[model samples]
Target: MNIQCPNCQSIRITTKDEGKKVGGVIGAIGGGIHGISGALKGSQVGRAVGSIAGPAGGAVGSVAGAILGCLIGAISGGVAGAKLGEIVDQRILDNYLCQSCGHSFSIICHAGHSEPKIVGANFFNLTD
Candidate 1:
């Protein structure tokens, strides 16, 4: 409820909408990287085995390649997703200003962003 503004040390409202678009962009980038990795891996594996399996083997290789690609993509995507989430939570959703004390600080969230908790040391204490 009470967030210290990083700039002026005034308590201001932190809105959830502040960084939603940026977070989404981050996720999309991550997902795209994962997808590309999957595709490349799958193609490599398929090509290696396809020549040996005849027509049926080629089909099987394609399927196997897809599965492998998807698995890798999912894993990479998950990591990217988490990082993106953290960026949103900390940089966008959690920033605020405090009017009462004029003390600006950041509350460490699970993903390393700042949110206001009732009792935590001010992240930036100018006097102290």
Candidate 2:
């Protein structure tokens, strides 16, 4: 479906899918960073525990801790990053720019796609 530009009343509007793709990539990077951080923390804790037990125990604990930490961190980070990306896509990135008048705006749809309205100065600017 195409949206009409509020300023020019032209139907030359398109969805910005590129923004969503960029958001996803950013989210993946953020998730990877978080995962590394979690692994580091887990290894530290494991080392501390192993120090009290002995050399063999410490070695085993460190390896186990690092693996567990990495997994948990990766999953949580990925989920959080994905959610953040989606929010950015919907709120800040997703938009329709008018090719005819250079007007940029977003559309808000109510329940069942009722009362879809443009939410920018072109739609509601009393001064204009």
Candidate 3:
């Protein structure tokens, strides 16, 4: 979407994806922690399966399974987090950035009117 800077009327706008970045980090950490249980289960399964190949194979399989489990959990969590962060961005954060004037703001729509509201600044109607 093309967005113009409310302060300078510049069309160069950047999205500060703070929520997405932060959420992804937090989610990855949480997912990694949660995946520990899965990893242990996977380790047992892998050991059982690899027993046909003897001790060396079982050891390798256990490590591989644990790593795979953790990776899957982290990836899934990061994706979920990013999706949630997108919602947060749309709902709560002033996600728009103006490249020309360095003004950060969000567009607020009320009564069918779309107006730019600067973050951490006083509210005023742009139409006025």
Top-TM-score structure, candidate number:
3
What's the lDDT of the predicted structure labeled candidate 2? 0.65
Question: Runs in model 3 with CA error above 4 Å?
Answer: 108-128
The TM-score of predicted model 2 comes to: 0.48
Assess every candidate by TM-score.
0.45, 0.48, 0.81
Question: Model 2, which residues run further than 4 Å from truth?
Answer: 17-22, 37-83, 92-94, 109-112, 115-128
- The residue-by-residue lDDT of candidate 3 on 40-61, one tens digit each, is 8888888888877999889988
For model 2, residues 52-128, the per-residue Cα lDDT tens digits are 89888778788878888777765666566666665665566535667887766666432147545443544433323
Q: List, residue by residue over 7-126, the lDDT tens digit for candidate 1.
A: 454455444433444545655566666677677778678967895978778777877887777767666666666666666656644433355544434454533346433433443454
Worst 10 residues of 2 by lDDT: 119-128
Ten residues in sequence with the least summed lDDT for candidate 3: 119-128
State residue 13's C-alpha deviation in candidate 3, in Å.
0.8
After superposing candidate 1 on the true structure, give the runs of residues whose Cα lies further than 4 Å from its correct spot. 1-34, 95-128
Candidate 1 Cα deviation (angstroms), residue 71: 3.4
lDDT of candidates 1 onward, in order: 0.57, 0.65, 0.74
Residue 69: error of model 3 in Å? Answer: 0.7
